[model samples]
Each structure stands twice: as C-alpha cells, then as structure tokens.
Target: MQKSLLIALIITVIGAVAIHQFGTALPAYAAFVLGAVLVAIALTVVSNQPSSASNAKYSGPTKTLYVGNLPYRVHENEVKALFAKFGPVNSVRLVRDRKTGRRKGFGFVEMSDTGADKALDKLNDYTFQERTLKVREARTQESSGDRD
Candidate 1:
C-alpha cells in the first residue's frame, strides 16, 4: 500500500508539471482527472486484499488452533460455524493435498485467545460427522531438512 501511494504521488507530480508547462487543454485536464481516479480505485482494491498468512484480523489477542480428524466432507464454513459458537472465529483453513486438492483430515482455526481456550476444551474429542475432532493450540511446523 505504501509503495502504491508513493507511485501515485510521483505520477501526480509529473502530471502537474506537464499540465503547467503545456497549458492544459480541456481534454488533457479530463484525461488527467480520469487517470487519477482510475489509479486511486485500483490501488484501494489491491491493497484491501487479505494476506496469505492470516485471512482474518482479530480485535484482541489471537490464538491459532490445530484441528485434526476432520471429515473429508468437511469444509471451511462448517468449521467456522462450529467455532463461532465459542467465540468470533478469525479464520478457518482446511489443509488440502497439493497434487490432488483433497482435504487432509486436518486444519487450523484462528480466534481470540480466550475463545480459542473455550473451543479447545469443549470441542476436543467431540464427535462431528461421525469422526472425533481433536482441537489444540497449534505448534509451528519444524523447518524441513531439504529446504534451504
């Protein structure tokens, strides 16, 4: 976003200098205004996109929970609805196989720390879709041996 703003400012300055030197015609002024508007719209939309790391933004302290034993049929919305009962769910990410794009029977959920604690207590070992769910605080994955 900062980068985008910087670029926009630079373009505006150059445009202003060109207009002042050339004695801007009506069409040139209109084009300048239209271009600025279009750029502003594009920048606003591009900057608002969610980051890949965490889709949801929590207002308070957040916790990420590891959810295991998910049914193959389960999905993000269902996980979110289930967790929403305990507290505001930040995000639900169901793991999928890279090649097959199939559910991996596990995922992660983010929420307020207090809400996450409640969810862990109540949902762990709870049966859902004929499978027992395993809910616990998520641990960072260890670095892979092959990765540089």
Candidate 2:
C-alpha cells in the first residue's frame, strides 16, 4: 500500500505540474485532489489493519478442556454433562472425520475462565468413561487453511 501510495503521489504531482505548465482545464486539478484523497484513505486503511502478530492474544472463547480418548459414540451433550459439573460450558465440539464422520478421539471444550482454571487443576489424569482422561488448558492453533 505504501508503494502504491508513493506511485500515486508521484503520478498526482506529475499531473499537477503538467496542468500548471501546459493544461488549461479545471478537471485536471480536481483529478489531482481525487488522487490525493484516495491515497490518504488507502494509507489510513493500511495503517489500521491489525498486525499478524497481534492475533497472538486470546480473542475468542476460552479453552476449558483438551479432551482426549473420547469414545466414538460420545456426543457433544454427553461431553457437556461431564464438564458442566465444573462450570457453565461455553461450547462442546466432538472432532470428527470428514468422510467417515467418526469421532477423532479428541475435541475441544470451552467454558468460562473461572470454570476453565478449576477444571484444569482438578481434571488432569481423571478417569471418565473407563478411560483416563487427560485435561489441560487448550492452545489455539494458528491458521491452518482449514476452519470456520
């Protein structure tokens, strides 16, 4: 955008010089003003975009649990029930295969921060559904080119 603005400013200055030197039309001055305004607006927009590193901060729902060893038929409601005892659940999602639609043995659970911290402290290595469930604070995955 800076490069484009530099190119545009140069073009506008050249046009202004041409109009002052040899042209006789008012529209040339208007064209220069329009170009200048466009360049200013573009620069403002570019400066306003968030830096790529800014997304390092948490922005969405808090990760309450990184559930693993989930049974194939375990549904979202059941997962919610298991953790609802800790706190209000924000969401429960069962990771599934694209084609087979089978459980991926792991999923994410979101909850209020208060509940999340408690669950993290108490649920690690706890047994559920005959499997030793490992729970922890979930980490966000950077853009993988596949997501909502």
Among all candidates shown, the one with the greatest lDDT: 1
Give each model a TM-score: 0.58, 0.52
Candidate 1: regions farther than 4 A off: 1-57, 142-148
41: Cα error in model 2, Å: 63
Tens-digit lDDT string for candidate 1 (96-116):
999999999999999989999
TM-score winner among the candidates? 1
Please state the error at residue 108 of candidate 1 in Å: 0.1
- Model 1 poorest 10 in a row by lDDT: 49-58
Cα lDDT tens digits for candidate 2, 50-101: 8653123334456557888777778888888777677677678888999998
